[model samples]
Structure formats: C-alpha cells, structure tokens
Target: MMESMISSRIDIIKPSGIRKFFDIVTQMEDVISLGVGEPDFATPWHVREEAIYALEKGRTNYTSNSGLLELRQEISRYLATSYQINYKPETEVLVTVGASEAIDLAMRALINPGDEVLIPEPSYVSYSPCVILAGGVPVAVPTTEKTDFRLTSADLASCITDKTKILILPYPNNPTGAIMDRENLIDIAQVLRQHNILIISDEIYSELTYDGEHVSIAAIEGMYDRTLVINGFSKSFAMTGWRLGYAAGPEVLIAAMTKIHQYAIMCCPTISQYAAVEALRNGMDSVKRMQEEYDRRRKLLVHGFNEIGLECFEPKGAFYVFPCIRSLNMTSEEFCDQLLKTERVAVVPGNAFGDSGEGYIRCSYAYSLANLQTALERIGRFVARVKQA
Candidate 1:
C-alpha cells in the first residue's frame, strides 16, 4: 500500500550506481576507493577561513533568493577571465545549493511535459533521471572510445527530433573524463545552430582540464544566448561540502530558473555563499596547485592501467580514467565486484554512468600517490587471476 503512494517516475529511476559500491565499501575494511568523483583535497584554507569568519560574524541570514550579489559578481568575473564568456551578475546568474541543483532547476524550468532532452552517454548519472522527474523524455546519444568518449556532431544531430528541448553537455565528463576542445565544439555548434534546442552545459570540471585551457561552448558565437552554463566550487576548489553552484545564461532563462529556485530552495547557505565569494576571488592559485597534482596522478593511473594490460585512454581533463576491460571477458560490474572482494580496491563500474560504458570502469586519481600505487598493484593482480581463470 505504501508503494502505491510513490510516483512512477521515482520508481523507474535506479539508485545511483556509484553510490552502490561505496555503500558496500563502508561495510568492509581496507578499501581504497577510486569510486567517488570528488576531489580528495581539502577546501583551500582561505575559503574555509571565510566560512569560519562568516560564522564568527554571525552573517547567517538568508541571502537574496538569487544569492549574494558580491558572490555573483565574482562568478561573472571568473567566467569572463577563465572562459572568455560574460554574464551580467545581477540578472543572468542564480546561485543554488550545488551544480546538482542548478541542473535540476534548468530541467524543471525549461522542459515541458513530453519534451525530450538529449544526453550523451556514458555520462554523469544524474542527467537522465533529472529529465524524467521534470516530465521530459531522456534520450541517450551514445559516444564511444573511438572519439575519446567525446560527443560528435553526427551523433548529436541524429538524436534531435521536433520534441527535443535541451542537450546536456557534460564535458570534462564524470566517469569518462572526456573534454571537448574548441575544434570539437565548433563542429557540435554547427549542428546545434540549425536546431531550436537549448544547452545545459555542466562545466563543473572546467578548471580541472589538463591539456590546453578549457573552452566553454557558450563562448561560441551563437551559443551564449541559448546555453546555460552550470558550474560550482566543488570539483575545482575542493569545496564539495560547501554546497554552492550557479547558473549563468540569458536574463529570461535566469529569471525563470530563479522563480523555481525561490519557491523550492529560497537561497543557498549564507556562510557557503560567503566562502564561495572568497574562492572565486583568491582561491584560483590553490586550484592551479590542485590541478597540477591531479595531472600527475592522471598520468600515473593511465600508465599503470596500460601496464596491467587494461586499455586505458589518456584523458586531458578531470581526475578520472575509464579503462576498457573487455579483454578480460567479464562485465564491468563483474570486474568491479570481484576486484573489490578480492583486492579490496573500489572503482566504479562504467555501466553506472550509462549503457555505452558497459566495458569500462572509472578509476578516480583523486587519491594519494601511495594509495593509487597500491590500488594499481591490487588491480594488476586481479587482472592476472581473471586472465588465468
């Protein structure tokens, strides 16, 4: 009887595949987890100090429904300086609890019932479920290792239909760590130009790009007006617990999202908003330092996986690497489960992200070099045993 009270939409969505492994790890000892997609570093001292100072000063009142104007201004300046895209802080930005909230707001505000949202798989798991909850159809446009898991113009164009309302561009993608460079975006933009689709570009990992500077699709000539860029302090600034993110786009869309935000969220935490202001203003040097460390680990993990006979692609952004395990003749889940039970190393199964990720497993390098070295050794042993079997 209680089950009947739940919405069918809620029933249809699977629990997060990433969280499933972590739950099991919590019950076990000596688990070295590469399953989490969080930065292992502490939030920078200055940013944490700002939060502490805000608490000491008793500035705990709710900020504006749109968020603190000062923080929004910093976000505007940061985007302009970092990505060469500009958004008016006053009318074009709405602060939320995290990029997660910003994504939810965008889907709810833009998706009419039955409208389809295009998501490139394998992707961060939230995109499809969020679209479903907002009464939108989630359409998967599968990407492959052949393109370094980056979405192509052809695949994107083929997925569009008259009912298509939004395309979620999750670059420096979670699970995959694939990034779309300027040349790649130009090709994608050409296909989008002829469509009426809006873009929700989740750029949470923007600062973590290891190659050249990260490019924003919103910076493309015709994209700025239609693209809502979602970003936050979590991945780059290591402020996951602070729970602050924002959306920058046209005033009309921002206004619409803020309306939903006002009713649903009211405002982001006051202390977090204050800390985020400091993160944007003075914490970029800390981000650079963290990026340097992540790049080093990224190289180590890629090399280690390849040496162990897993075919790993070098990812230019983010701290995760998706190594193919097809040659082992087991499913992604089977490999992850057996590795965890045998070697006590925790990595996420790629199928947790989407169907296209079935033959891969995502390993985050956001761990100490010692832990990564040990995990690599354990994984190598597991691979050998599986091959011998």
Candidate 2:
C-alpha cells in the first residue's frame, strides 16, 4: 500500500477467465451454468467410503513428504496398466496437492529467468500464469479448429527459438475437448527431440477420451526422458475436491519437482490420498458410468448447438463443447454476457482459454441431461433472437 508492494511478476498475471464468469453466474437465480470445467457427478461411493474409513480409523497424520508409498505404488500400477508406461513408485513418482500444484511445481523447478515456455493455446488457463510466476516467458502457440485444435510439428517448428525451454502439452485439452492421437504426438515429438526442450504433458483428462484411448507423450519414443506427465484423481476419477495428483517422469525432473513440492505442500491431504488409492484400484466402473453419461450429454449438446446455428466441432475428449459464435456478430465476452443477462444460461467465453478462443464459447457438458436440455433451449432462444435482430 505504501509503495505498490506487489511484484511485477504477480501484476502481470490475469485473473482466470473461467472463474470471473462463474462469479457472475453465482449471483443470478435459476441460471443454468455450463461455465466451470468440473464434473457434475458426486465422488464415487467407494472412493468416498475409503476416505471416510480413513478418517474413522484416525488416519489423519501426514504421510511421507513424497506422499504415501501405497498411493504412489497404486499410481505406478495405474499408469503402467493403462498407458504402458512404468514409473518406479519409490524414486520416480511424487504425489502432490493436485495436478494444478504439480503443474506449478514443474514450472518452478524447470524455468530459469527469461526462458521461454511454449503453451499451445485455447488450452488450459493455468499454464501461462504459472510460467510467468516461475520467471519464464509464456509463448502462446495458437492451434485452430481447422486441425481440430491439435498442435502439429509444423506449429512446433515455427514457435521454437533458442530460448524455448519447456513445451506445455495439454491434450484431451480443456475448453475445446481436443485430444492428440499417437501420430499427432509423434510428429510433435520429432520436433521436440531436436531441441533441448522439456515437456509437461497434462493428462488429467486422459480417462475421459471418447474416440480412442488417450495417449500420453511420455509413452512416445524419444520423449519419456524429457516429459513430465501430470495427472490426478480430479478429472478422471471425479475426485476434484480430494486434492490429489501425481507426476511421473525421468527421476531427475521428478526429483526436482518433489523438492519444491516437499517445501511448498509437504504432501496432499492424508484422507484424500487414501481415497485416491481406492480410486486407482477400484473406481474404474464408476468412471466408465460417468464417462458414458457425459458422452450422452456431449452428443445432446453438440446436436443442440448445431441445430441452433452455433456450429460446434465434436470434441473427442473431456466434457466441454467449444462452439463458434462469431456469426452472432459479437465478441465472445459480449456474447456470453448478453446471453447470461438475457436467457440466464451461463457458459464461459472461449477467449478465457486464449486469444485464439475469441470467436467461440466453451459450454461444459458435465451437467444432468435435464439441466443440459434447459440450457440448450435457452441458448437456442438467444441465438434466434440475436440472428433476427
């Protein structure tokens, strides 16, 4: 207050575009919100029971700084079984507060001042800000709906410079629901192998893929040593409130991330770690049921948007539908605001994800079919009214 005590680095970061809209949604009555990228389902019963059991048994004490060895071993098995990637639970796996914390830790451990971090845009919101906070320059590489929002080797080549240090690979991407297949990752890997860059692959939505199995870049040849795979129980296991995630990679980088995590977080919540262990070991049936329901909502929302003239590309992963709203002749923010004020149906403006997202709006399909139907009806009315004017 005396002399503007906030550091310039903190000043440079913008508030999350997602939460900014969500704040407004909370104030309005009967507003059907499609804004937040959160699962609408409750945490699976078995997983919740595990946490409850932990608390009942007085399992409230902190585990090792690297997190419970049992949980890490479960994470190791889950990764190996699901993705054919193996990480030693003892040395290579470090559990953290969430994938959010893991992402921050990775950035803090890897970035040097003025280093460049290539973030594929129209992706998750946290990547850029975390890089800036870590003293790195964030270079947003735009990907288009033309290629289904997948970052290509050519795109990688164009953005590379001597200063590029880390590439944030967010697949099964947020906002757009785009996923990078093996071929897409292989192309990008070839380009990255030539550079001294490391990769932070956020695979939080890996289990939510609708088309084929999700691919992790670390499993790709020539990439394992250079890739830190960030994943968690938040998305796939419907455990967002649990605050548990883990990172696996070459021990060197994992060790570095663990060092920061130990100082910053020490470990995740003890009960959440127990819940997540149950999630890894036995929550697949619940995950499948949720994914199936989200798929139903996804189909309904995409069809409804197209019928209303908001043409949305079918997203192959995650639970969001990014639809082009440019034909309505408004900025994404303007469109979202007007829609909220008029119909009370809330979705985030796509620009919240990146500037590349300006002409679109991201509608999450994680709600009930009844809610989705109501929101869709209201949105259709909004689109018609705008077009007629």
**lDDT top scorer:** 1
Report the backbone clash tally of model 1. 0
Clashes of each: 0, 0
Q: How high a TM-score does candidate 2 get?
A: 0.98
Tens digit per residue, CA lDDT, model 2, 1-389: 94588777777898765676677889999888898788988899999998899999999998998899999999999999999999999999999988999999999999999999999989888899999999999999999999999999999899999999999999899989999999999999889989999999999999999968988998999899898999998899888988888899989888888889888888789999999889889999999999999989999999999999998999999999999998988999999999999999888999988999999999998899999999999999999999999
lDDT of 1 by residue, 9-48 (tens): 8987877766766678789997888878899999999989
TM-score of each: 0.98, 0.98
Please state the error at residue 181 of candidate 2 in Å. Answer: 0.6
Q: Model 1, residue 75: displacement in angstroms? A: 0.4
Which residue pairs in candidate 1 collide? Answer: none
- How does residue 211 of candidate 1 score in lDDT? 73
